[model samples]
Every structure is written in structure tokens, then in C-alpha cells.
Target: MKKLLCLLLAVATVLAMSVLPAMAEGAEINMFISSPEYADAVNELIAAYKEVAPDVTINYETTQNDYPTLLKTRINAGMTPDIFSTTSGKEIADYAEYSYNFAGSPAAEAMDPAVSAMMVYGDGEIHGFALKGNYFGMLYNKAIFEEVGIEFPRTLDAFEAACEKLSEAGYQPVTTGFAEWWVFKHVMQHFLDAASDDPAALVAAFQKGEAHFKDYPVLYDNFFRFIDLCVKYGDNKPLETDLAGEDAAFGAGKAAMMTGQGAWVEADVLAIDDALQIGFAGYPVTDDPAKSQIIGGSDQALRINKDSANLDAVMDFVNWWYTSDYGKAWFCDVAGVIPPITDAKVADMQIIQQGSELSATDGAAALSICYSSDSFNQAMGEAIQAYIGGTIDKDACCAQIEAKWVELDGAAQ
Candidate 1:
């Protein structure tokens, strides 16, 4: 009876979501975004905007793989977008000169204090506001767990034991999308962060060329453990699977759980079976609970072009984004996105609830992007793929990644 009620609620929630109207107004705003990860949610938000404000058009453009370079090129060339998206920390510094200051807006005021601190710069100027804050860890199928008779695992040993049981029960223990560079990088960040005594300090040293992955035996061992998790229980030819395939496989109950996934996978999973119950938890990367933490934090932000002719419309949208109930509903209820507003309502979705609880605990770290570089992340990801593909030993993978970090540091000098 309880399961039936939950399924009905899920069905009704999807039904209540509004689709954007087919027609559009004349003016179109070119909005440059870094990735297609949030494309669907952004589109839904745009559609909702069109219904009330017909004249303002939002044309979404993605640089995808070439986002960082193209964004730099465009910003440097002064070919500014009417609106753009940004990530936390130094990433926003590149576009700070051209981004409009949101010093006194509702959006700025509503931002979480810590996240707001990351956006402010010279003279206390605010350059961007977080559009979505996410938690990344282990996303699992609740139904599979019930069948396997295993509760959530809070330690590495227990997690591995559950994986073994799930495998013996004729279910794939875990599903991963190592073929996708970002997915591999995401998992590596989680593993390395959990393995370190002070992930931030270690990463700072690595960034400064004072330390390397090989310098931390914990990282080296954990990297292999991560690989082992995928190799032992991942779907056949795991390296061949992409993000879409991995999500679909888990949605179809091919796997009991997926590590390194978070709230982002909820919609994809529920789409396959509205009745399927899903849950999320912190990745117990170590045997000791004190050291384990789920990777999460402010993932994306929104900024406006200081010189765009549509500043009024852009500002209007920005203000409306936080001040209006429609914006909150569209983001939280419709898109299942947790905006950074301090007053935002908690979504009734169970997986989101789980992520929130995990994030609030002492054992959670913000996505540690500030400590690593793009070159270093790419090298580590490639090495992990190679290691999992059976071409490189664990030591070779760690050594090459360390060498790549040193190489990247030298080139930066």
C-alpha cells in the first residue's frame, strides 16, 4: 500500500510539470553554456519563461567539449553573450571583467553565504550566482537492495561485501561510465579526496608541484580499489558504456547501484520506471567512517554580460529567478534542481532528500575542482580508463598521472 502511494505521487508529479509552449517571440537571447549536462532543465526553465514573457527569447548554445577554450576566446574577443553560465572559484575569474555585478539583487542576497563568498571579488563585487548546487556520491536502486537484503553501506568493507552479494544474486553490482571523460574524472576526484588526510592541502601541494599522486599511497591504493569495483561488478565491457547507457542500465535495474552519481541521475532513473524507488548516499571510500565523504557543492552559476543591450531583460530574469515562486517551482519541482537560494523549499523527492542529508553531514566535501587542474584531471581520467581496460598496471597509471601533473605545472610557469 505504501509503495502504491509513492508510485502514484511520482506519476502525479511528472504529470504536473508544464512543457514550454511551441511558439516564441521575435527577440532571441544567445546564452552560452559550458556543458549540455543541464540542457534539459534550462530548456524547461526557458519554456516556462516564454509563456509569461513572450518577447524575451533565450537561445541556448553549448560549447560542450570545447567550452573552456571557446568561452575564453569569445570573452577575450568581447563577443559577449547576453547571459552565460559559470562554475565556482577561479573559473569565474576569466569572465569577471565582462560580467554584470549582482551586488544588491535578490539572487545575490538569497545565495548561501559560503557559496556567495566564492563569487565575490574586488570591492566586494559579485560576478555570478550559483544556479544549482549538487551532491555526487553513490546512487542506488532501492528495489534491488530490498531483494538482496542489504542495508545501505557506510564503510568500504561493507560496501564491497554488498557488491559481492549483489553480484552473486545475478545483478550487476555497480555500473560506471568510464568511457565518458567527465564521469571518470568525477569518480577519481571522490576517491582521491576520501583517501587524503587533507585533500585540499594535498591538492594545493600537487598544484604547486610540491606533491604528487604517488606521494600519497592511500590515493594509489584507492584508485585501484575504484578500478576493482568497476571491473568486478560493472556490466560487460564497462569501458564501452557512455553516460546515457550507464544511466539507462541502472534505470532498468541492471545494476544495484552506481557510484559517483547523484541527484542528476534521479530524473533519468524515474523516467524508465516511475514505480522504481531510488536512493543516494555518501561513498564510503575508506573503512573508517571519519575519512569518508560524498563529493558535492555548488556546481554551476549564472552571470550576465555587462555590455549586452538586453541588460534590463537579463536583470529582470535574474531578479525573477529568485524572487518569484515560478522560478523556484520550475527549478526545484519541475526540473528536480536544488537552487542555491537560502529559502528554497526542500523537494519531496526521496533521492534529493538523501543527497541533502548526506551533504549536511560532516563527511561531505564540496566538489574539489579548485584543487585540481583540467590537464591533471584529463590525464588521470585517461590513465584510469587504460588501467580498467587491462592495458596498464595500477602503478603505471599512478606514475603517469603524477608525471602529467608535473608537466602541466611546468607548462604553466
Candidate 2:
């Protein structure tokens, strides 16, 4: 009887060991994504995840400059990261072939509907997730606006008048981050929204070579007028001012308004002057104040490589990041970002609070920037930069943009 009991115990122990998860032996997941601003927060999240997944390692990497080009190079070399990122909407489809469709996964289920809506690809398969839902608009120094005795403008005419007031009061009216290509997409989307009731459909038509910028006065006339205004009252070197330059000008209290930025810059601006009175509002796209509504939704998407060597481990980490209590709270507490998951607490930052209030009362415009891929956006930026540099006239720039939209995006279709 004693011998039989000992043999039975040994057998049970062996069965338990055999049934243990493969994770017990350890696995490494390589995650290379963009939005380097969230690197610290992500590192913290990775550290916390280590506790739950002690045996699984996550090798994280991020970049802000030429991220797409680098990612494509790695992908072509057959060295795709276990996790990667692309813009949420049309680019989701651009990378669909390489991404996992984890529609029913816990991470996908936890995603906020507004965000998940952009992550959907063919037949409703979820191809990606976001670090945070985003709000795109203008950021202003409230103190300067008050000192200049003018409100943040909501109409093109009002914006010009306000710029005159700000400039007269010895302040740069706007710090345009025109040096970066992505900045053009951020600023152009507001004008795009004002041009059409269904901006997505309009974008598709343009991509299909069925639409022209000349047809939309709001885009060709008012939009260009606004850009001219920005350049007129903007940075001394409008074509040379990048995001950091904008941040420096605004944070130092030299600029009254900052364009081509949104909630993401709040922390950095505040860091420069912790007591800075940051104000958030949409661009003055036209004469209609209502049409200048703020844009909201996640513009960036983080995707899982469908063929990752440690696919299960990657999914496990993502699930834990979305569903776990620590993970949910990290967005607000650590990242100080708008939560991308439902039922999570919002950050107390000024831009976030103002954005939520504006979104509730005035409603936000669709995130029109996502309707097209970054490739077209980059080309458009270059053409516009040439226009700003006086190398190409406005008509020439418009012609180039329309042709490139059809050539790059239309071909993909």
C-alpha cells in the first residue's frame, strides 16, 4: 500500500509538469512601434507586465523619425517585429497582410468603440489597437489670449483679426510646425472635414481619381487663405519650424497660438511652464464656427504580427495590457493620455479635459486624416512645402497633390 501511494504521487507530479504552459520555459516578443512620446509610459507598463509574465520578455523599441521607412525596410528583410504600428484607418488595410486579426481577443474586446471602429479591416476583423484615443486641434496660450484681449478664433475672418491683435501686442500669432510632413496631415484634416459632409467618401473619390481640390473652395481657397494667414503671422522661419521649435516658441510664452498640434503637446508645454494656461480648440476652417469642430479618434494603430514567432506570448501581453487593472489605470496615471479602452478614468490634463467638454457639447469632426495613407500625406506635405518656399505656385502645388493622391492611393485600390 505504501509503495502504491508513492508511485501514484510521482505519476501525478509528472502529469502536472507536462501540462504546464509553454510560457514557463520563457519567450521573447519584439515590439517596434512609433509615437516615441509614450516610451517612458510603455517602459513602465512593460516592467509591470514582467510581474504577471515573469517568464516572457518584451523587447520594446520606438522612433519618431522616418518610422514607416524603417519598418518597411525591416519587413522586406523578413525581420518584422513581433508587434508594430501604422496609422489606424486606411493604413490598417495597407498592413493587413502582415497583421493579425484578433477580433475576438480580450484586447480587441476592451478597445473603445470609437477607437475599435478605426481598427476594423475586411469583414470586421480587428487588425490593431491604440495606446490612446487622440484629439486633434489647435493649442493656445490662454494667458496670451487674455493679455491680447481676444478669444481663440473660430472663423477665418475672426482668426485673421485675432492674429493682428496678437501680433500688435508683440506676440507671434501662431507657431506652425510646417517642417514635419505629418504636421500637414494634422492641420489639413480639419480643412478636409469642412469641405465635405462625408469626408471619408470624398477622400475615397479623390483616391479613385474622381475628385479635384479646385471643386472645393473650402479646401482650395479658404484653406490656402488660412495657411497664408498662418505663414504671414506665424514663425519668422515658417518653413523651418518643426515640433520642437513650435514647443519652444509657445512654451516660452512668445507665441499666442500653436498649430498642427493637439493634446499630446500638453505635458511638454506644461513641463516648460507648469503654470501655463493651455487652451484647446479646433482650427478656423471657414466662416462657420460649427464647421471648425475638433477632431477625435485614434490616428495611430499598434498591430500584432500574424506570424510572430511567439504569437501566443504577444497576444497574452496585449490582453493583460488591456484587461488588467494596473494596465487600464496606466493610461491616465502613467502615460497621462486619453484612455483607449472603455470605462477607464480620464487624465486630468487641460487639453484632455477641454477636449472632452468640447466633444460633449459641440461634437468632434471625423478623424479625416486616417482616410488616406501616410505615403500620400507625405507627398502632399512636400508639395505644400514647395509652395511655402515659393518654388511652386499654389496652382502647381494643387496639381501635384491631386496627381499624387491618384498615383499613390489610387494604385493601392
**TM-scores, each model vs. reference:** 0.81, 0.90
What RMSD, rounded to one decimal, does every model reach? 12.8, 8.8
lDDT of each: 0.74, 0.92
lDDT of 2 at 94: 84
Model 1's alpha-carbon lDDT is 0.74
- Residue 268, candidate 1: alpha-carbon lDDT: 79
Q: Model 2, residue 116: what's the lDDT?
A: 94
lDDT of 2 at 403: 90
Q: Which 10 consecutive positions of candidate 2 have the poorest summed lDDT?
A: 20-29
lDDT against true structure, model 2: 0.92
Candidate 1: Cα lDDT at 342: 69
- For model 2, the stretches where C-alpha displacement exceeds 4 angstroms are 1-24
